[model samples]
Target: MAENGALLRVENLVKSFDGLRAVNNCTLEVRKGCLTGLIGPNGAGKTTLFNLITGFLKPTSGRIHFNGERIDGLPPHLTFRKGIVRTFQVPRELKSMTVLENLMLVPSDQAGERIWNPWLFGFRVSRQERQIYDKALQILEFVDLQHLRDEYASSLSSGQKKLLELARTLMCDPQLILLDEPGAGVNPALMKRLVERLELLCHELGITFFVIEHDMDLITRLCNPVIVMSNGEVIAEGSPEEIKGDERVLEAYLGGQYLAGT
Candidate 1:
């Protein structure tokens, strides 16, 4: 297990595509129970770093530490089994599945998963399914989507789909959640709701979040100790307030006018 108190840590992490380094010798730590933010301009390699950490892409060099063990090149499913889960910029749901079923499908190693077990051990499988269903209902209500539990995932609005996605992640009881962009297409009202739910999850449930976001306003309002990446490398790390005024950050992405206005 990862010692000290960092839930996730990357040291000298690097990735390259056709000799073009996308994440170059980057190093960062996400402490346990933190709602940390990662933000940068387009092509800043933020997503690539997320990919590396989540095992979507293996690092060309360096190590990734999660909960004190080296999880550098583990497959995505294995990484998830180890309690590091990631959601994409675009929510991916089983469109034909009900919201409740979608949530039920995330917790791996379910007794109902084995093709033979469900048949030979029907009662056991049924009991397990009931447990998963009950858990799914609770998660749906936690994310305020219980009313839509029976609705097809495709029927949900974009914001509701985002909520569904967040609900599904809770099924695994992950230690760290890598959110690509929770506020990407959400409207102000829904974004506020999402932020509030996440804050409650962080402070109350103590779920750790390592987020990648572009909305500076959302970042400033919701995050602390934001990490900024530029040109495939981390350029700065500090509080949201400090980042808003940093000359380098303003020059790289947020222009002086925008910084001044904020």
Candidate 2:
């Protein structure tokens, strides 16, 4: 945990489908302004847990608190408005839109979105649109995508798309961002850049991150208080060094035979 207080807490989180539990009584907490890692082998219910926290899926039983307020049953949009945002393993971009347009669309509260705004006050709507455009460009610059701001999202490479997705997440000014496999399909060079940007965002922008990543090296370098899960339950929680040397973690990552030899 960081010196700051707990920003989010999960208590006895449980989720099941067809009588088979995908997430089993998992409990964890994310410290404010800290980077946390969530790791597990295949079928460990990592994504399911994310879905539950982000309100994409409802839990069978559990509680989630953000800034001391209960948020378990809130819808995704409400959770987002409350300063929790999540990115997918695959970048979800509007292929037909420009990168800048994509960023502009991320802000949840749009004044012009109402049907009456244009008809009642066209001038005000235009001014607000310009402001949104300028903000979008600034965010693109922050993500180092300013040069491609006008290009269609479909034209971007996978790494660029991932960066765009991260940029879009920032438009909301999120307090806690949940990244699901940010490096899954990204190239090594761009992956390194992504890690650096994430570090800067936490250190400079004061944003908290709860990352779900399989890349142990990336997790070790970027996150503290790593959480390890196996068979839908948290098996260990500690610093990178402790997790690396843990017997249960090794068993979860490598199988019992390898752990026995170790």
Candidate 3:
């Protein structure tokens, strides 16, 4: 049920490793300013699709577009620069760095990265660093992690690490974000926090999210026009209620997965 005017588009996309097709003829749309959810059974090509969209893997065939520009075959860093970024299921924060430091590191074109820039434009670099730190503090506060800004990422719980990862992603100021199983190990309370933060970001910041989530309740509560996949292809797309009731989905997944959480 993909509609027109999508901010992200996947058209006849395919990926293969050796002789096996991991993603086959996948086509979908992610509209701007929506919190889209992608749900599928294991080996449904969810992560493979994410990798292709994020440019971590070159597609075996087909095309991808973001913000009206072709993005397929671009490198991951180039894709990120085009305002599409992704977060992993396991939070990838730097263990030794403070939460605020982690966020500061995500922004690109930093003045401190080059060797000569430090001496030639040290004052400008310091000013830029200060600005980034201030913004990082604001983002940490927005995600309700300001108090933990100075804490090492390693010391945080599984849930807090996820929160930190989300906050860091914000530093990049992406227009579209692809998230892989954000609630995998989070507790209920922190999961609620993550959802609330995501809602606020979506509405207020106008950030678009395409997430892979296994928690039925979470997806049903947060997403609309939910998309379901099976055998590396999209099999169903509709409201959460409609998807949960789809006969095709039931036959392929929901019938057995209904009792299991993901």
Query: Best by TM-score, which number?
Result: 1
The global C-alpha lDDT for each of the candidates, from Candidate 1 onward, is: 0.88, 0.88, 0.87
lDDT digits (tens) for residues 180-262 of candidate 1: 98888888998988999999989988889999998888888888879998888888899998988788888878475545665
Estimate the lDDT of model 2: 0.88
Q: Model 2 Cα RMSD, Å?
A: 2.7
Model 1: residues with Cα > 4 Å off, grouped in runs: 1-4, 257-260
lDDT (0-100) at residue 120 of candidate 2?
90
Ten-residue region with minimum lDDT total, candidate 2: 253-262
Question: Using Cα atoms with residue i matched to residue i, what is each candidate's TM-score against the true structure?
Answer: 0.95, 0.93, 0.94
Worst 10 residues of 3 by lDDT: 253-262
**What does candidate 1 score on TM?**
0.95
Which pairs clash inside model 2?
Answer: none
Ranking under lDDT, best-scoring first? Answer: 2, 1, 3
User: Which regions of candidate 2 fall more than 4 Å away from where they truly are?
Assistant: 1-4, 256-262
lDDT of 3 by residue, 75-142 (tens): 99999898888889778889999888889889597888788898999899899889898999999988
